[model samples]
Target: MARRGQRQSGATRPAPQRRRPARDADGLLPVLARAVREVESAVERSDVRPSVRTKFQVVALLVREERSRVNADHTSSDAYRAEQLRRLDGIATILAKSAARETTLLGLLAEDAVISEAAASLKREMLIAAGQEPPREEPVSRPTTPADTTVRRVVPQTVVQRQLANPFLAPDFSSAPARPPRPGRLAGWELITPLLRSFEHAAASASKALPEPTTLRTAEGLELMPHQARLIASAAAGHRTFLLADEPGLGKTAQALLAARAVGAYPLLVVVPNVVKTNWAREAGLWTPKRNATVIHGDGETVDGFADIVIVNYEVLDRHVGWLGDLGFRGMVVDEAHFIKNKKSQRSRNVLQLSERIRTRAGRPLLMALTGTPLINDIEDFTAIWEFLGWIDETGPRAELMESLEETDLTPADPGFSAAARARVIDMGIVRRRKVDVAADIPARRIADLPVELDGAIGRSIRDAERELADRLVARYETALATRTSGSTVDGIDHDLVRRVAGWERSDRDSAKTGENVFSLVRRIGRAKAGLAADYAAQLAHSVGKVVFFARHIEVLDAAEELFTERGIRFSSIRGDQSRTTRQKNIDAFVNDPDVSIAVCSLLTAGVGLNLQVASNVVLAELSWTNAEQTQAIDRVHRIGQAEPVTAWRIIAAQTIDTKIADLIDAKAGLAATALDGSDDEVAASADFQLEALVALLTNALSE
Candidate 1:
């Protein structure tokens, strides 16, 4: 970064390069040549930071614009035109070398590489530095297109900067209008309903044949499972629309992110459930580290509009849908696509509208409908998901689907049309892979951490409370040290003193019920996390079936149950508060009922005497005081009778005491057991956890 500044400011630059500069009529060419040379030097040194990358992009853009002007200048002689073109070609060659040296820079030259404001300003500065007037901004002549008039639309400041930098969106000359299909035998046949019926009648496995992957590793060194790589490989082969119905534990988030990168889908829009929105951004950072991703919370006050990826939850789609349509996303991914099965729902409408806008603008944008399971009884929802994929519209099949149906040479009147039609739709990119299908690639039992950011007022209050608690602990430690009776001094923090102080605080809170203690604080965090955890579990239920949801507190369990009921997902609850017979009955219902998607279990009670191998996925909604309790709950599903690999999704609130406790559990209790069944830690009560957490918190405070 410092080198980039030096290169731009010229404070440390050699004077010889500028003193004997070659002359050009307008001087723009020399400026571009000099910048490109600097970029080349940066590339050679492997120091292509954001500023250098922006400089490289601005240089390319200027060279292209200048070349176009030079070609169109009727006043300039052929000799002059030839000379300018040759010089532009020379700069272009350097750009190619710079790109070759730093292959990641090549992505910036792609069509969808967004021109950041910095790059735009750099372009103008270069022109002015070369003794040419900067281009004037044309007034936007378009009239106001009022949309969501009642809804307050938030345009983040960064987004405004980007908009102001590039007022005119790059035109889509790549998409030529599609020729209307030749009228075939299936012409007037009300084909969409039959297409819906075909899926029902031909209820075979809907997984599509995928291309073999050329590489299984991402640029960030994350290796893809074989099944996941197959889908990414298919996307690279130019298959845009996909209904990725991979089961819950199959790393769908990673696959979706990598697939987006495969096609260079920048300014990508991801519509996910509220619970998993933060997880989506985290996965984006892991799989596509070079790209910037932002999550839209509330009215999107904190959103980074300049980010390459925009993640939003379905609940707030109504508020931001208006501007999201105009955000110039080249791709759309609907996670848990079954959420939009009802086209009448506002979420469905917003997603479809956004998909339509992306398709209309991007010509052929990448559209993926991700679900674990299709609504078996509701073909209407499948139609809605297909609509979101742009495979069909209101009246009938879209151009792509219609063309595929035409090639099959069969109508609904034909004998084998159902099977053929379903096959064609599957080929249009329906990829379904279950855990058993890729069991060898993953551990038989695993815990996948789903870090959820608690946003809005509730999130802010919790953080405030945590800080207050920390401050109180810090004051206690300082007071104790200032008036030490033993006269013992330590250079660094006194770990013993911190623990004794934490114990005193915990005992006071338990006795007087005064300030927030670690126990009560944890419960508050649990309540805050309940909705997110439940929402994630709902997604799992929709995608796959038979998930176990375990929460430490009844309030967390109750909150989760309320959410599941609101979402119309069938669930059975097994709690310590329930009668023995009632608990058994609920457990039996969960084990036996196909409609029961989730079994909400108590971490303590359900830890013993249960064989719930029916579920391969577990949702640990709240943290347990002991590792044994949490391990026991997950073991119900990850036990001996389980046929497929199991995944326990641990939901932790990011940037809070919740994260600290989770880390402590993994480190102090035991890290991920991997092939081992359980942790080596003893099963102590919640008091031990409370003491340790407070100790860790106070120690951190004193260190700061």
Candidate 2:
């Protein structure tokens, strides 16, 4: 069998010697065709051991380079050049279709994307196949002086003192040895895809049963729910790692802390989103009062280096990861694990690197990844989560999972392998239970979409803006089709063309602020609807005791707050610009003070972590771009302790893109339901939402 990282010997053998064309077209066409065929086959057969994403990136990068070359080749005749350009366009069309199947691949086509070593090697091989010399690598120069080359970390005095006080930290590797691969039918295949596919194909039922607990209460006098207790018991019984994916408001924070206590995994480390850093400390105090907890602020001005528990946010992890790794933390917990879904992200890299260090220093330390929605867009979202729990690494399954897969003695081609593979991973410790399954333990929650009509001149202007955006996109699409060579047109609207046009517009929208793209149009609609939504929220606050109002833009929040003030309704504001202390104070006012009837929140700032169960009704003044953000907003009010049924009033504008986005959000929500809630529903990936929304708008405009 070929070893890992070894290039396939016959993968891209050079094409047979032939007369090179005057222009790159003759030399590149056959090579591009062969490369595309090879990549498509690899993707179809799942033979790219590292990742199909890498191959996709390679194809995309090559397509971009070849297109530039074909367009600039001046030596060829006009007729010949046009013919070559058409063929190149055909290859590009194929690349677009491939990317469309997997929405994540579209991100690799960005202009500033960096080429990895593997991708560069593949590109060189393709160039060799085309009988062209690849570009020469530039030599990297080294810094000459120590002052110029030395790397330093700005360690705080307190952290330095702690490290100096305990200088002899030993590495621990006593958990278990790497299990030998057993003789089986699936002995040498790339198993990650098959493993992930198992989750995709398996029934979305309640997760497998956890071991029964020996205790039901914490030392702090807080009673544990049956499900929470089972997880604690599992940890107590030596199950040191878990993907604790119980739905929100199910006491996940309490369960994680108590589980640490059960295993004596103290000197614990908790990495959470910035909004929840303070909340983690609060939860630690409530559930594990005996253990001292400290929250690290910038520069650690008042950090308690001696505390038994350390809580840090993702934003500041880079500065503290160096010392935290040396502090000998016996346990680690990452809240909102989905934040690390993109493995290339800096936060994800830092989290994974720190987790690796913890494993080395405290062998078999308790590690947990807690999130309500683990699979946000695709099944592969589980990759980072699994890595955090130490169940799998980038290459493939780690020790424990490999042993289980070996026991199965089956391959992806075998019958019933997916279910068996899923069971194995779940058995490793994936605790998932939805609110509906434990409805009696938590308040019932529902999302009600409230469509409001805009009938004034302002409404007509917003509608006109939407029509103009759609027309612009349709014009671009038609222009692209008209420029194509004859006989390549299709009957229906080319959805691929639609996505490309949308992607180009979205790219332009991101780089420039003046354009009226989908983003700007949506913001305009939000601005137009702000008054109406705020008025509705004020009415709801008067009828219902308290209301939590969420909006995306500062102008919308400003408008909402002004309207509330004008109406004589008391409201508290929580925004991203406020300091930690002020933010916490505002949150406290909203939760504890009954006189505050409304909590006007910035959806991006107050969405994930702050608990606002004091309010049973939530008014979304503007729509969020993703379903996760929307759900996180509503969960603040619908969590565990609320006594009444929770309702989220999503104020969407009628006869506009707002309605389409709301529908798209609902469609995307099914992904989380299928993965975490065990629902058997078909779902579109959230990555496709932007493109699909654009398609719907353009199709609407064309029909009109």
Candidate 3:
């Protein structure tokens, strides 16, 4: 680099000569070697001194030797063949870089050679004039090989020809035909047309039919973030009934309330999970005017009152499905609509039926749904909920909806559909935001795995037992994992397989005398405990900033708590059995206290909107087949205000059925790629899991 820079600064350089060196593909190797030997021999001769020509000869010999070795074993060895090919490609790159630097050097050298030759001729003439002997001259010849070929010289071009040379290198243009424009008020407005049309209509409607602009108030006391405003504006403009699909802790409820104010379309009904009814009511009162919002906890009088907004839970909505119409609500919002994703469920049926009644008076009352895990495990889930809300057209039941989603037979060759039509349908109604694209300013997160070693004596016994019954165990494992069977059942069989293979469940009566079964059980327990501890330690170690550990089972939570307690790790738990008050208090402590390093909780208990941005790590002790549940759990740490990038890590046992289920869950959730544009975690997980491929793997395992 220094030498190159020096040359660039217009420093003096060595001259070039026509007698430089002969270049060849293979033929010049012998000549180069002879030149090198002669130079080396002369250098070694005490009487002779080596010249620049001798030094170049030596360098050329070394180059020839290296090239010969590269090509010699090119066919016999893959490494050598690759090396030779690499060198061939590298030559052009090296030459291109070298040409720019060496141009002046070469030109100067060539010119100097002419001067040297002239001076030598003058000296010879003087020597002959003075009656002295003239110096001997060597013959000059041009190189015959590709390597020695001089750079091609071209005649200077006129200014016009130079100016008109191609403007830039050719661009890679797509061969696909352009899409026909969608018919709309702003049809020719290009990419921003949809947003423009929606905004214009919203603005016009707000101006013409709503109350005076001065009558409305910017939300007081409760400060609105920029993203919150974007969410509200987008909701008011995009869908008649918008789904507040932001992740947990992003204040979807706040956005919904603000949007109601924007459109003057209140006298609204807010439906959420039973557990969060009070939280919603409290937020509403704090964010909006006191008398404008009312919470309906099985209160008929309160719901019937002419309040701006009435909030209810899903459980109550199902119970009073038809009665909602009597309230004369202008809009209805569904929170956690994933609960109603199953078309046959009572909640879904009730919501669908109630939608009809609510619309009867208000001209299809604006139906908005809120969910973080929108497309839980399948596209059919979306179809089911959206069709009910009139986001998409309803054909019939599950079978018909599944057909529209094209879960199976989606290939272009499948005569049932065309790719163009599918793309068109997908373009509408789905607007997703991911942690990576929108939440990129957040910090980085990581997950690490730790392996534990077992005692030699116990390990040896387990190994011996496993080896003796290897074939039997494989058969049993396979039989249990059949596609016709449930994965939980398969997991149960694998558990038993491990116990028996490790000789922890002996049936012999005499075996009890030496306490063999008891000892083996102890060993087994130790192994399991070690595995769990190792996983938790690795995850907790990665949680230096802030972290949330999710425990699906009480035993798992107990184990994690015990481990943390023993290690003196600071944490608070929101167990499944805890009261709502206790849950909230602990959550507050985790988020407010700087000393609190981790917050452990049951996924089901804390899956709703509970902002815990104080942490950046989320560890899932176990996985659910439902992507919605998993997503809601992960979003606890990933929402707005999180200073760090949130990472959700899962601890999976290698070669276990748990690994397979985790893979399937990840694949199903990965369909949200469009929604999660910059999500590195999502991209990595997508590569790790393939639901269809996993099912095939399970099938193959069962058959084997």
Candidate 4:
């Protein structure tokens, strides 16, 4: 064999070939593959705090680099380029899967996601892991000359005075200890969802038992209810934080003002909805006569810096947030606290940030989030409320709550954790009481939906518009099916597909100017029913001492006011366009003036904060999109001071989307019941009335 081994060696030596190590058959770069694996592993582990943010940044950076390389490579054939792109897409798919595991991570994938310093650092670490040199950090250039900008807000003199009075305001940490770190059993696991789940499963029993009142202290002539007195007792016993979710008519206003009085939480800050700013001051006077309460108007020209109680509305909170933070308030009460449920809104941000500053400055400060209808859509609506109460922070439970969760010896994954978590949170100051529970303390309230038939051309036009809209939606759904690659046949109609089509139609309605949308159609129905609703309200005002007529549109209000004027019925107008003084004057005319038989109010402006309990009967001229709005309107008359049973008449247009919307509002009310009132009813996941109305219309059209 020609010296067997020697011959073979000579043949190989001809080229002096070098053997390369095995690589992925897919041809993924070694560095990129390593980075992908590392990131995937970190994101897959729930206990590792899931490096979701880092993973998103690394994958995003890789995608950008890979796209650039693919674009610049002209040597490669289109097929080869497509294959590279597909491979990169596979990496992106993994990153998406990782994000799907943590709901909070989804926001990072948004098109406008900002690359923070931490994200940039993580990108470099990922690049280094991929055996590639990270890009050099570019030096941030300083401007040669500072740009001049006008100052938007000047520090108020009251703020300066307050600061001068308490120059050494320091954060009190005595209530929250830093030592002996207490990591809970659920410390590593996300517990917010489970904590909320507990509320969902809570029984619809009456209010939970409260501590016995040690001493019943009533404000001069103000007689406290048994439940109200009990809360005052708890405050006197040193309970600092409370989420007073008692139903609307249970005297939350009185309770909040008096509770502050009991704890000596003077120089208290009460943040309320604009509609209730005046009401808060009035209630403060009634409940705590000794404490001087001042309401802050625009620019706060009339605000008393040294008043015992300072009341400000949410609308002007932004302008006042800076000074309010430096005002050294010992207690804070946020009325209609559900306004801050959207944690991302500027209003919510200002409220939560100001609350945080107050908590930091006065560790033992009394914080209360008072909302009769707290659970608007979801149980997690409690997030901002809990934050306002200082029981939890942005990261997770605060030290005291963490300690409580730790003592439970269970994680969210455990079976018994939910109840334990609920008990723990409830013990930390969640007070939920329904009108049914305290029925004796307050009058019963009923919502009566009055369906009216629309006749003639306008009515027919409305019906035709609704049918046309539904037909359009159905056409879209069919088109989507025809284009689907899979020839899959669905039974009846694919509800999910139907919902998707409805959602598209609904969104299109917002921007589309040529077509009649659900919103416009509802408005049309309101217009058609305006005369009838006004006639009924005029009749009600005569039968029932006073009637509060509420409507969503100014046109409807104008029509009702015109009818009232023609009928010789004295009426007062409360609309958003009116100045605060005008609004107050109109409100007073209805409340204190016997000649003012009706208060024609904007459902949005006069709904939440005004105490129209003076009128036991309310006429809702048009339906609202949400049950909360409707409840707020009805509650304006069904509050604590009302001596008679309250009835709300909701005018619904028959044989139209208005009836369906009225039903949807009633259905949506179940969300609050299941969440706050502890009803076991199954809550519809989506409380979006407009979407539901579109779905109903499409379903009906498709069926026909």
Candidate achieving the largest TM-score: 1
Score candidate 4 by TM-score against the native. 0.47
Cα RMSD (Å) per model? 21.9, 22.1, 29.5, 23.5
lDDT of 4 by residue, 1-704 (tens): 23422322433244236232233443335555566666667655542232445555556666877778898999999998998888787777666555434333444454334455445545544554454444556222221211111011335667667778878876666676334436545657776777777888566432335788754557475566678888888888888888887755567888888889888887899988553565577677777888899877656766777789998876566557878887778899998787687676556778888888887777789998887663423678789889888888777888778888899888887888877888888888878775556667654887766556564578789989888777778789899988988878898978888899888888783535767888888888889889879967875664445889999998899989877875679999988889989989888999999989999999988887798777877888899988989988988887887776677877778779987898888878866776778766555568788899989888888888
Q: Write the number of the candidate with greater lDDT, choosing between 2 and 4.
A: 2
Candidate 2 pairs with clashing backbones? 204-678
In model 4, what is the error at residue 130, expressed in angstroms? 51
Order of quality (lDDT) = 1, 2, 4, 3
Ranked by lDDT, the better of candidates 2 and 3 is: 2
Report the alpha-carbon TM-score of model 3 versus the true structure: 0.34
**175-229: candidate 3 lDDT, tens digit per residue:** 2222333333322222212221222222111111111122223557445645566
Candidate 2 lDDT by residue in tens digits, 1-704: 23211333322434333332232455867777766666566544534333455556666667777778778988878898788778877777666655433333444565434455556655665665666666666122332232222111346677677778878866666666446455566666788888887776555662656888776777656777788898888888889888887755577888999999999998999998654565577778788988999988655668888789999877567557788878888899998787687676546777899899888778799999987663423779879888888888877888778888878877788897888888888888888886557766554887866666564477788888887788787788889888977667677877777777877776674523534678778888899889878866875664456889999999999998877765568889999999999999999998888889999999998998889988877999899878989989999887887767677878888779998999888867766676678665545443566676887787777666
lDDT score, residue 491, model 4? 89
Q: What alpha-carbon RMSD in Å does predicted model 4 have with respect to the real structure?
A: 23.5
Per-residue lDDT of candidate 1, residues 474-581 (tens digit): 888889889999988888988888888988887784532546667777888899999889978887786677899998888899988877765578999998889989
Cα lDDT for residue 307, model 2?
87
How are the candidates ranked when ordered by TM-score, highest leading?
1, 2, 4, 3
Worst 10 residues of 4 by lDDT: 143-152
* TM-score computed on alpha carbons, candidate 1: 0.74
- Model 2 earns a TM-score of 0.48
